[model samples]
Each structure stands twice: as C-alpha cells, then as structure tokens.
Target: MFAVTVDQVGSRSDDDRVEQAIDVVSTTAAGRLVLPPERTAGDEFQFLLDDAGTLLDVVFALARSDGWSIGIGVGDVEEPVPDSTRAARGDAFVTARAAVDRAKDVPEHLALEVAPGRRLGTADVEPLVTQTVRARQRRSREGWELADLLRAGHSRTEAAELLGVTPQAVAKRWSAADLRSDDAVHAALARLLTEADTPAGADTPA
Candidate 1:
C-alpha cells in the first residue's frame, strides 16, 4: 500500500489552491485510489493507493504545479480499511507524515519513506525518483506544451499542426525537453517503486 500526503507550500502567502490541486490529482488518480483524496488538515490532503504506477501518475500530476510538497509512504495499512483517509491507520500514514515534513525542506519538494523493517530497498530508489522529478520540474513551458500534445496521442506532425509549428520544430522541442528520457525513467521508476515496496524475502510478481 501507498499513502501520499501533500502539503501546500507558501500557503500563508499564496491563494488557497487546495481545491484545485485536489481536482487535478483526483482526475489523475481516478479508479486507482483506495480512498478518495480529502483535506486532512489546514492546506494539506492525503490519499491511499496500492499501485506504484498510479502513485507515479499522482506524483507527476502534483509536481506539475508549484507550491506543493509531496510525500509517499510505502507499507502495510491496517486491515478493515476505512472509507476516509483521515480514519486510515498504520505505519504508512505515520511514515507519510514524517516524509511530508521532510519534503518541505528538500530541493525537489518530494520525499519517500518506508515503514520501519519493511522495503529496505527504498533507500536506493528514493533518490533516483527525486532526481527525475527535479529534472521534470525544470522543463520549459514550450516543452510542456509540446509534451501535452504528444501525450494526448498526437503525432509530431499533428502536434505541429495544432501548435502552428513545423514537425521539425515539434521534434526539436521533444528532444530538448528530454521527453524520450522521461519514458525510460517512468518505466524504471515504476519497477523500482514496486521493488522498493516489496518486503525482503517476499515473492514479487514478474
């Protein structure tokens, strides 16, 4: 299981965006969430999920916007799960809280934690995930525009037409944005996250 906690950064100075953020994440996380995201405290929200790929999607969606500190905790949740995230209990939630607090001070504003005595490989995986997210955060607006179009299933020619640019230009943007590298990173991160979540000596699905 994964528990994600997000806290609004600069909340005192910025306009309240909790609702908007929730909307974005909820959309990205639809059908995969164990508990629908909900505000847990002032300017903070939490959600539960089981799939690492969905967790990655949720993290990327949140990272697209500024002013958020994201933390993911991987571990077991107490059985007899509650319908509300706030009511959920276990090491996952505890570690998520700690992870979020640490995230506020991190360069990428993201962090990962594993319940003590579980998923010891998380130590190796977290840094790579953080670095990839940091690189993604540096992507330019033009890069994002092209990326969005391509991600929507538009071919380079189609995206170019939509953006009123040449296909060459679209290709240039894609290369400059390192979007190809993102694909590899995404696959690696998902696999790594799954491994990190798997307890030592436990059988992991191929």
Candidate 2:
C-alpha cells in the first residue's frame, strides 16, 4: 500500500486550502484509492492507495499548486483496512508521518519513505520525483494551460484553438515547459515506485 500525507505549507498565515486539495486528490484518484481522503488535522489530509501511477497523478496534481508538503510512504498496511484513512494503521502510515515532517524541511517540500527492511532497486526515486515537481513549479500559467489541454488528449492544433493561439505557440510553450521531460520522468518514477513496492523475490512483469 501507499500512504500519502499532505500538510499545508503555510497554514497559519494562508487561507485554508485543505478542502480544495482534498477535492483534487479525491477526483484524481477516484476508484484507485484504498480509502477516501480525509482531514487528519488542521490543514492536513491523507489517503491510501495501491497503484504507483495513481500516486504519481495525485502527487503531480497537488504539487502543481506548490502549497503543500507531500509525503509518500511505500510499504505494507495492516490487514483488514479501515474505512477511513485516519483510522488506518501500518508501517506505511507511520513512515508517511515521518516523511511529511521531513518534507517540511526539504527544498522541494516532498519526501518518500520506504518501510524498514524493504530494498529498493538502484533508482533514486525521490530526487527524480522532486525534480519533476520543481519543474512544474517553474512552469508559467500559459504553459500549464497548454499542458492541461495536452494532458486531456487534445492535439496541439486543438489546444491552440482552445487557447486562441496558433499551434506553433502551443508547441513553443510545450517545449519551453519541458513537458516531454516531465512525461519521461513520470514513466520512470512510476516504474521505480512499483518496483520499490513489490515484495522481495516477487516476479515483476516485463
């Protein structure tokens, strides 16, 4: 299981954005979550999930806003899952708590913790994920607008039409945003996470 815990970056001074974040996670991870996202405390929310791809999607969606510290725990969850994330208990949840606290001190405001005794392969997953988030943070609003359209399966010409810009403009924004690199990072990160989560000696499909 994967446990994701998110804490607002500046909760004391900023308007509460927890509700909006919960909505985003819930929507993006619909049908993939082990439990519905729930507020764990003021300006904090958490959810459990099993798929690495969905985990990336949820993390990317939240990281785009740059308002939350994200911690992902990859490990085992105790049997007989609870109905609510707040009620769940396991190594995944424990690591997620520690990971979130660490995220507060990290430059990228993101962290990942694997449970004790789990051996991950050679890939440096956290740094790759952090770089992707940082790239998204650096993206301009226009870049993101084009990215969103492309992500939703729109062709470059169609995205240009929607944005009232020429296809060349959309292509330029796409290259400037380095979205191709982001897509590659996404695929690599997902594979790394899945590998990390697999039990020792388990066979992984090619």
Candidate 3:
C-alpha cells in the first residue's frame, strides 16, 4: 500500500484552491484509492492507495496546478485503515508526514519515502518520476494547454482548432515539451510499480 500527503504551498489565504484540489482528487481518484481522501488539518489532505502504480496520476493532480507540496510513501499500513487520519497508525502514514515536511523545502514540490532498499518502484524509478513531474510543473502555458488537450483524448487537429493554432504548430509544441517521452516514462513507471507490487509467492496460489 501507499500513502500520499499533500499540503498547500504558503499561507491559507488561498485555501479555496486547496479545497478545489481536494474535490478533484475525491472525484477523480476513486479507482486507485484505497481510502477516500480527507482533509487532516488546515491546508493539508491525505489519502491511501491500493496500487503504487497510480502514484503518478495522483502526483499529476497535485503538481499540474502548481500549488502543492506532495509526498508519497510506500510501505506497510495497519490493516483496516482508520476512518480518519487521526486514528491512522503505520509506517506508511508516518513516512508520508515526514515526506510532506520535506516537500516544503523542495523546488519540485515533491518527495517520496519507501522502505529502505525496497524494490517497489525502486530508488531508480523514484528520481525518474520526480524528474518527469518537475518537467510537467515547469511547462509553459502553451505547452501545458496542449498537454491537457491531448490528455483529454482530443486529437492534435482538434487541439489546434481549439487553441487557434495550426496542427503542425500544436505538434511542434507537444514534441518540444517532451510530452511523448514523459508519457512513455509514466507508462513504464506504472508497469514497474505493478510488477514490484506482485508478491514473489503470488504464482503459488492455494
């Protein structure tokens, strides 16, 4: 299992933004979530995941908006997570708390902790995912607009029409932003997480 803790960057003056972010995660992340996201305190939210593979999507939700400190922890959780973050007790949650604290000091606005030397997503994959997420966070407005349009299943031509640009220009922006490479990296990372999550004994079914 995995835990994700998120905190809004800076002061509470813009908390409506955090509330909206919470709503987006609540509505869009049901499939990947083992625990529905909850606000634990002012400007902070937390959730649990049944699959580490979905971490990338969750991070995207936090980072694409550019206003969050997102921390992900991969570790054991006490069975039957408590109904609230207050009652939750486990290494995963603790790790998430520490990671979230660290996220406040990082430029990328992301941090992660897993069982030391654990192979789930591996240390290698962690940096790769972080780099990719940072790339997304750094995207220019035009770059991100194209990415959002394409990610929503719109064709390049459609995106062009919507942005009032030529299809070739849209394609150039997409390529220049390295969106295709980022997509490929995300897919590969998801596969790695899936493989890592499978128990070695899984094939020996009872």
Candidate 4:
C-alpha cells in the first residue's frame, strides 16, 4: 500500500477551527483515509491508497478551487518486515510530512509531486537552522522573543501583546514547538534545557 498525505495550509490558530476545516477536506476527498493529525495542524491528513495516481489526481482536483493550498506526498514502505500494515502507515506519514515542507516553499495553487529523494532529511539541516535563526532574529528585533515571554510566565495572549504579533502567531509558535502534546514536549524541553545548561562540546552526537 502507498501512503498519500494531503496537507492544506491556512491561517488559523484555534485548534477546533483547524480540525473542522481538515475534517471537511478529508470527508470530501477520496481513498482509505487516516487523519490522526496533531491538533491545530488539521489542514493535514494522511491516507493509505492502493493507487497513487488516482489518489493524487482526486486530491489535486478537489483542492484546486478551494482557496487553499494543498500539498501531497506519496510514499511506500522502506522495507519488507513484520507488521506490514504499520510500515505502510509510517510511509504515509513520511510522505505527508514531505508534502507539507514542499507546500511551505512554494506558492498556493501549485501542485507538487513529492519524489522520495526530494523529501525532507535529504536536504541539509543547516539551511533550515539558518532560516529559523533569521525568523527568530526578526522576532527578537521587533520585540521580546517568544521564549522570553513564555519564560516570564505571560499568558498566551499577553505574550502576543508583548511580542507585537497576533495571539494566533504566538499559539502557532508554541504548537509548532510541539508543546501542545504534554508528554513529548515536556520530555523534549527538559532534555533541551539540560543540554543548554551543560558546557558546550560536553556531549556530542554520534
């Protein structure tokens, strides 16, 4: 089975609103669908399809006139092993993730075919890191960083006020940082804070 992930990008911060939008899109689309997306990122949906060509065509056709940008990824299992069903699901997830990245780079109304080689991780992380730094720099230049505002214990809306950006933007940043998921984000942040407090070069990647 091939995994087909369709991700729609829109401007919204409310998790409920985003989920509703995605639900509309998924219900209106085709194939055996699985849409267990992290909340607020609802514009994203993943599906397992036997035919890639048909799935891609239908998704593109359905999305073309919706005033929304949609990206798709087509992925197959990396290896043949036990739990074939689970493996296919993983492939579908990776494909959808690649599609999201492609959509971010291009303008709306453009349909991109996500070849495996062009998917994420194939590209160097330094450029992404640089872009993130530039965005952070711009935010810091405009006002206090989101980190500082959060560290100061300001409410989400209050942090937005301090940063001179919309409350949605603040929420997006927080969610994008994976803080919405209690266990994953807490563990990640704890490890990051620990590493930061440690001396540089004390722990190196293998």
The per-model lDDT (C-alpha) reads 0.88, 0.87, 0.75, 0.44
> What clash count goes with each model?
0, 0, 0, 0
- 3 or 4, greater by TM-score: 3
Clashing pairs in 3: none
Return the top candidate by TM-score: 1
Candidates sorted on lDDT, descending:
1, 2, 3, 4
Give candidate 3 regions above 4 Å deviation: 12-16, 120-122, 195-206
Q: Summarize candidate 1's per-residue lDDT along 1-206 as a digit string, tens digits.
A: 88999999999998889999999888998888999899999999999998888999889989888789999988889989998999999988988888999999988899998876654555777898898888889899999999898789988889899999998888899998998887778888888888777777788747
Record all residue pairs in model 4 with backbone atoms less than 3 Å apart, i.e. clashing.
none
The 10-residue segment of model 1 with minimum total lDDT is 116-125
Model 2, position 91: C-alpha lDDT score: 87
- The residue pairs in collision within model 2 are none
Model 1 ranges with Cα > 4 A deviation = none
Assess candidate 2 and give its TM-score to the true structure.
0.93
TM-score of each candidate structure, all chains considered together: 0.96, 0.93, 0.85, 0.36
Best by lDDT: 1
TM-score of 1: 0.96
Q: Judge candidate 4 at residue 182 and give its lDDT.
A: 31
Off by over 4 Å in 4: 13-43, 65-67, 78-89, 109-206
- Residue-level lDDT of model 2, residues 78-162, one tens digit each, is 9899897898999899988988999999888999888765557323567777878887888999999988988899988899999
Error of 2 at 57 (Å): 0.5
Model 2 lDDT on a 0 to 1 scale: 0.87
Candidate 1 residue 159 Cα shift, in angstroms, is 0.9
